[model samples]
Target: MVSSERLADIGYKTFSGTMTLYGGYLCSLRVYRYFHHREQLRIAAENQTEDIIKD
Candidate 1:
């Protein structure tokens, strides 16, 4: 798992306004962010499902 500081470092390094939008580092960051978002959504859905089951 990537630490928050490491993600910050990646964001800082990639979006320093000196690099192109198509850089590999930026792409990886986007993908990582996407998956992280998805994971959060999945966890929330599971919690909601559990609550419904309990009720």
Candidate 2:
């Protein structure tokens, strides 16, 4: 049988691990979004340059 202290320890570790994983997920998403936006801006710039050259 688990003691109260043991249960509290398990709960704390579980919460900490969950938060760590969630933090990593958020960071990964941020990086993906940043690159996606950068790519879109680059494409827009290329299109604009092409239009200017055509004109």
Which candidate comes out best when scored by TM-score?
A: 2
- Model 2 per-residue lDDT at 46: 100
Model 1 per-residue lDDT tens digits across residues 2-54: 99999999999878745665576789999999999999999999999999999
What local lDDT does model 1 show for residue 45? 100
Candidate 1, residue 16: lDDT: 72
Q: What TM-score would you give candidate 2 relative to the actual structure?
A: 0.96
Model 2 Cα lDDT, one tens digit per residue, 16-55: 9999999999999999999999999999999999999999
> For candidate 2, which ten residues in a row score worst on lDDT?
1-10
The collision pairs in model 2 are none
* Ten contiguous residues with the weakest lDDT in model 1: 16-25
- Say what the RMSD of model 1 is: 14.8
